[model samples]
Target: MKLLMAAGIALSLACISAAEAPSNYETYYGGVRVDSDPRLLNHYNRVLAYCDREASLPQRGSPYPYDTWHILALRSCLYRYSFVDRGVHSYPANWFWGHVFEQ
Candidate 1:
């Protein structure tokens, strides 16, 4: 019983950590690359802050996890701030699903 309890605790901890882990969606999608331009960097920082807040909330009418919503929010925020023009316009649908399943 003790061993089983330990295993359960470990599994719970693992799941919690995985859920909270930051997504590499920005890196994969190539939006808002950091550079020497201070103004652009500031804008990037603001976008990140906005996405972080957006990701923290439980998304209504969506079944996906926090990180998945985070990816969507980040992309939207980047496009809203005009950062996407400097990077690739779009990503394949599989890429989004891959991240979703990774969690």
Candidate 2:
């Protein structure tokens, strides 16, 4: 009985961790679905990194309020690559716009 209980606990723990694993794309800015192409993925990652750096800075006396600056910056960067918005906003499902790499 003790062994069975231990196994059950371990299994539950494993499931919990798996469920909490991070997705390949960022969840904060709606949902972005990047293509499997290496170039697109690299570009997406670079945009994310750049946006992250931009977001970390203080936004004192900025025209955009709160997190607007970050969102605008992200949109601007992603737009350069011709990312399309799917118009879904469910979040964690089909939310806001989707970004894809078009060659």
Measured by TM-score, the strongest candidate is: 1
Question: After best superposition, candidate 1 residue 23: deviation in angstroms?
Answer: 16
How well does each candidate superpose onto the true structure, as a TM-score? 0.41, 0.36
lDDT of 1 by residue, 1-103 (tens): 9999999776543332111112222332545345545665665677767655665556611234334445555556555655542222243444567679899
Taking the tens digit of each residue's C-alpha lDDT, what string does model 2 give over 1-103? 9999999776543332111112333333445555445665676677656655654456522234244444444444445544533333313234212443221
- Give the lDDT of residue 94 in candidate 2: 42
Model 2 lowest lDDT segment of ten? 15-24
- Provide the overall lDDT of each model, using Cα atoms, as 2-decimal numbers: 0.48, 0.45
Q: Model 2, stretches more than 4 Å misplaced?
A: 1-33, 58-66, 90-103
What does candidate 1 score on TM?
0.41
Q: Residue 98 deviation, candidate 1, in Å?
A: 20
